[model samples]
Target chain A: MAVDGTRPYGAYPPGSETEQVGIMTSTVTILYFAALREQIGRESQVATLPAGGMTVTALLAQLGQQDPRVAGAFAAEPRLRVAINQTLGGLEQIVRPGDEVAVFPPMTGG
Target chain B: MSVPGAGVPKVGSPEMGSPELDSLGAGIHVAVQEAPFDTASEIARLSALSDRTGGVGLFFGQVRGGNGLVSLTLEHYPGMTEKILHALAHEAVQRFGLLGCTLIHRVGTLRVGEAIVFVGASAAHRGAALDATAFLIDRLKTGAPFWKKEEFADGHASWVAAREEDEHAARAWSQDTPPPA
Candidate 1:
């Protein structure tokens, strides 16, 4: 059961941050959707950020280095958008630890 | 104007303890569900939400069968989608001084020609209602978080890219959408 009644779209796995980041507190739950999700082959992941925080652009650059699929997807679709904690934001927005970051292609819904 | 589902209904009272509305009247209803919404019922409900409503405007979008499309799959960010949709609907209601409004967007896989999204707004005059309706849908296309993937008859499926024209439409409305006259 999801924390909410709705099905779990994506949630952090149990202690996923600890497992990935070891002792880093600068970790965030990252989510992908649509074309980006399909390209990345994973719906969500917990990633460790630098000590303080990083901009949405910096986070993508780091993630792309860790996984080239991220690079290719963003390269193929240059219009990828990002949101911090479910709020749509620009690439320059700073993403802090424990924030939920979502990266996806342009919205086609109405 | 007597019984519901009988004769021409009036924009009158909601049923006792109706979840859809209350004595104060529900100003907005936003649904991001899988099942298709009844466009006619939604329009009627919008008008019935208030007695001062003189006109109602509706916009419905159905999937197109062109380009050998078989079905379209809609994916949305669950927690984020509802939040953004309600915010959009609330803005539409307040901005247009609408009496009430209903906005529904369907998810899951849908066949061609199926209703994908619908928005209806009621107001004192047609202008407010129509402009609100247009504003709601246009903003939703660019603002909402739903994504669509089209499945072709040849077993090839592709995600629908956001259209530039949609951005222009939303921007146009933001510039100077007049109030009710």
Candidate 2:
């Protein structure tokens, strides 16, 4: 809920993640896995969150705004799993600065 | 370096990397790698790790053929995979009164009939070791961060979905009682 209402949800405005650079308050490295990774076309990317941190749900919601492909990926799958750092996390988990967040589909390996 | 989509699923961070230790302790041996492991060597290692090992149980899983499946790819979060697998192995040792335990999962492309996973447990009695062996794999199927994607000979591939049965099995272990010390 800490996301700024004035600006839009997507981290970069065409490239806000890198354009704003040093001005952003919180930066998180987001990781993609499994089907999501295949769809996103990248393994990992950095994103920014407004001050005071935001819930994992909010972060994903923001990332969903990145572009049509990202948006489509989030919209396509409803059961996206999340983890803060390496431990599994709930939707309400508060993602803070410098956190390594992972988003992936449900596990199926034996 | 991990080449994500290059068909080679790497284990651990590029810098941190998977630890090559044979066994961290007398009670736990966990590894996430791409190479096919020697099951006999692993069982012998676990047996020799503890002096009281009287019962050693093992379960080895391989990629199944048929259904037009050509190969299967396993994906996992490097650092997290290692951490969780080790924790589960340690827990089984305690919960089953096991003298030692082993859990290994292979990542990357595995053709049909190729080995994919190995779970083993050793204890003072047959019952504890047997139950622990089951517990280790059941819990791992649900708790571990690994994911499986199946590729068909028809040129199609899809990630496997999680199964409810695995979740139930992992939970059943929680309710079961451990053997007496």
Candidate 3:
């Protein structure tokens, strides 16, 4: 079960000084959906974001490099949307450790 | 409106309930069921929830008789289903200044003339509500992970293929211009 956490705007709430310099550490959850889920063969997984403030696009690039299946699904850009926590966000959205990030194809539900 | 021991959340449980109103709030209702739904009551529920809205647009999708086909079974990836619906609902809210919305889709065995899906939207005027309702339904049919298996009257069954037109319909919404009427 994905626990519902209270992170506004899918990012960490503003202002908290807990920077771990040079450690490159943060626990995060990743969610996949639709054809992306089918291609990845897994719906959800936990990962550690690269240190030095990773963006949604960079994280996706990393996933693509790690798994050819994921790379194939994201071969074309702008076909997918990233949401942090639960709200829709842009590719520039900053991802932090312990944040829940979800990547899905363009939505098609009522 | 209720199912026992299905592990599904209740209609107004806090974890899944809306804070703006007594039940699931004035806008949006989401449900997944195994049995047939009563169209009249569903419509009434949606209408009753609408407030200060000038129009209510409804889309009721039904199983069709394809000569010998008699029933259909729907399947979905559970966790993904909820996540996708929640995301879609948020988009609908943003796209249209909707007063209220409702989505009810039935899974498992369903026969012709039975309701397969329902989408309702309310807005200050007819245009937004009507367009948003259509957009939501079109997107849901193509985007969601749900799949249908049709059963013929002769006991034959097969998975329904995804239509390219449906994908096009969904993609059209991403554009700035309105779809043709």
Model 3 C-alpha lDDT per residue in residues A63-86, reported as the tens digit of each score: 788878778877743467677755
State which candidate, 2 or 3, has the greater lDDT.
Answer: 2
Cα displacement (Å) at residue A66, model 3: 19
The lDDT for every candidate, in the order shown, is 0.75, 0.74, 0.65
The DockQ-based CAPRI class assigned to model 3 is incorrect
**Candidate 2 structure quality by residue, lDDT tens digits, B64-113:** 99999999988887667776776677677656777788888898899999
Comparing 1 and 3 on lDDT, the stronger one: 1
- By TM-score, the candidates rank as 1, 2, 3
Interface root-mean-square deviation, each candidate: 12.2, 9.3, 10.6
lDDT of 3 by residue, B1-181 (tens): 2222133333345655455432323366767666666777766765676567787888988888977988876655344455556556657766787776877777666788788888888777888889988888988987665667778877777656566688888889988876887
lDDT, residue A104, candidate 1: 90
For model 1, how does the per-residue alpha-carbon lDDT over B35-154 read when each residue is reduced to its tens digit?
Answer: 778887888888787679899999999998997999999888765776677667767776888888877888889999999998898999998888899898888998888899999999
Model 2: per-residue Cα lDDT at residue A2? 26
Choose 2 or 3, whichever is better by TM-score.
2
Candidate 1 Cα deviation (angstroms), residue B15: 26
- What's the TM-score of each model vs. the native? 0.82, 0.81, 0.57
Candidate 1 chain A: worst-modelled 10 consecutive residues by lDDT: A1-10
RMSD vs true structure, all candidates: 8.6, 8.1, 8.8
Q: Tell me how each candidate scores on DockQ against the true complex.
A: 0.31, 0.31, 0.10
Candidate 3's C-alpha runs over 4 A off are A1-110, B1-26
